[model samples]
Target: MSNITWSFADRVVAITGSAIGMGEGAVETFAAAGASVYGLDVDAKRGRAVAERTGSTFVECDVTSSAAVLAAFEQIATRHQRLDVLINNAGGFWEQNTTESISEIEWDHVIDLNLKGVFLCARHAIPLLRQSSAGRIITISSLAGQTAIYQSSPAYAAAKAGVLSLTRVLASELGADGITSNAIAPSAVLTERIKVVRSAEERAATAASIPLGRYGGVDDLVTWMMFLASEEGGYMTGETIAVNGGRFMS
Candidate 1:
């Protein structure tokens, strides 16, 4: 991602789950545009390496813990003294279980990571975000949040649904403060995780099922994310933009 100097020069961004996958894509995208990013993830070494490549700072954050989230944001604020954007991109599939058999422990774990994680980060980031001239919050969600469930557990779907709802509520609450909150709900994206987890035949089958006859790439969502984080996207708020390659039209 070659940078455009005019787009994101000197912007302050904090993104979670940035050690890999779509989160990594965002880190690179923002950095390419000249933003100084605070990349947060569980993998300290990999996160730092990625940040080094982009001239970003690395923060080890367990998004589910409020204390960790607070500390991480405080550290970012201390260094940059401002936060212009935040992407709550943590959370993913937990265990394979339906409502009938999903244990309470598993449910709580996923919810805390997915929904509570976003809440905690946003709850703490508000003050710093408000200090910026253009504050933006983009939460990474999924089609599961708006549609029926599938490969993911019920807890994942429910938590993402909560994120979608929270997007709307936060937009309403913070629009007056010059902050915008939005979500990206994606489907079958192509990543190392997906390639390693699914066999070729299974992956091909899923791709064929999509209307585009292919799985989504990280670049697909990165484009939309850039828009949401850009001045052009200033008018967009409380939007749950679906980037599923027409797999599920919403």
Candidate 2:
């Protein structure tokens, strides 16, 4: 690890799905970096609590609803006037069934959350991000998007693939405007959610499979996010940084 530190002083960063999990981690990370952070999530109570704890602002917004997304961005714009970094991290994988076993509702829900949500947030964040000298759009994707994973649902894989494509397009289109777009695709991250779901043996097996002999953590992601949002990372765009402990190489 480099001894150098990255600063976000006076920067404004916006994150989606900020109530818990990785989103909450981002709030803490950015706030610690001296950035004014704003977190958006449908879980008002938890989101507000997280914001208060992390010294960030929280907005109640559902990524699936375009109206809610627009309204939230409008509020951010009103308060901050500019957004330096926008992280699209609001997504979930509920139904991990095979194609034949998955229902239409399940498919739609997964697609809406993982894929459409990225579009909704990006659509509203562009103008504000463009105003910043070092604008960044960093999205959360999955290893499943690049290749089929046994534990993931078809919808999740497809939606994440869509996110990568959208990221590339944003990078190409927004590069001229001094904006950079990128993504992070993590695998077997040992979040609290993962701890609850995976048995110790399963986790051990997973860890063994990875060359690093351990699962990734929120800090692993935080490192990449901070780097991409920093001045030193200005040259990187349309790239997906895999924080999977070398589990999958591309």
Candidate 3:
């Protein structure tokens, strides 16, 4: 990530799934850069703790629930009246199953969390984003969305692919409003969840396969996110930046 510094002073930034991993890193990074950050997540305890450490606001929210999403954005609107950046970072899948092996409930849950949540957040964030001179919508997607390089939850991959499509839709619809919508598709990011889900041997093997010869840290992805939210990134939209250490090239 280097020593690259971005000043988001006076900017109002909202990030979903801000309790842990990449989301939590973003909350701290943005807050440190002088932005007024709101960290939203379903885990109230960890969310609040992250907020306290970063000096940002914490809103308990489930991005999957329309009502909860509305309320969370409402709170942001009441406080800032506008938002400069919206980071759709809340998403995950529990079971790794084939398409046919996956149950309906599991499928729905993954889709809702990874895909629908982005839609809901962006849907409500558009108005507030319009108030900013250069509104930015940055979504976190997965390499699984781009390709089936390895075994993964079928629903997770599908949902992430949907996110990429939705990013373009938002960009197309909001271009006139000066809102730039983009997505970051990352792989081999060494988050806490990755540590739990993959055995050490699995992690090592994945790392070796990457051209960079290592797994990416949270900052690897978050740094690109910061760039997309920065003024310099305002000119670009509807594009997906692949940050996978050359693991999968398009």
**For each candidate, what TM-score against the reference?**
0.96, 0.97, 0.98
TM-score of 3: 0.98
Model 3 scores worst on lDDT over the 10 consecutive residues at 1-10
Q: Write the residue-wise lDDT of candidate 2 on 50-131 in tens digits.
A: 9999899999999999999999999989988989999999987886799999999999999999999999999999999988
Candidate 2, residue 193: CA error in Å? Answer: 0.9
lDDT of each: 0.89, 0.91, 0.94
- lDDT for each residue of candidate 1 in 162-183, tens digit (9 for 90 to 100): 9999999999999999999999
TM-score of 2: 0.97
- Top candidate (TM-score): 3
Candidate 3 regions exceeding 4 Å error are none
lDDT of 3 by residue, 1-250 (tens): 2245989999999999999999999998999999999999999999999999989999999999999999999999999899999999999888889977999999999999999999999999999999999999999999999999556899999999999999999999999999999999998889888998899999989999999999998998889999999999999999999999999999
Question: Candidate 1: how many backbone clashes?
Answer: 0
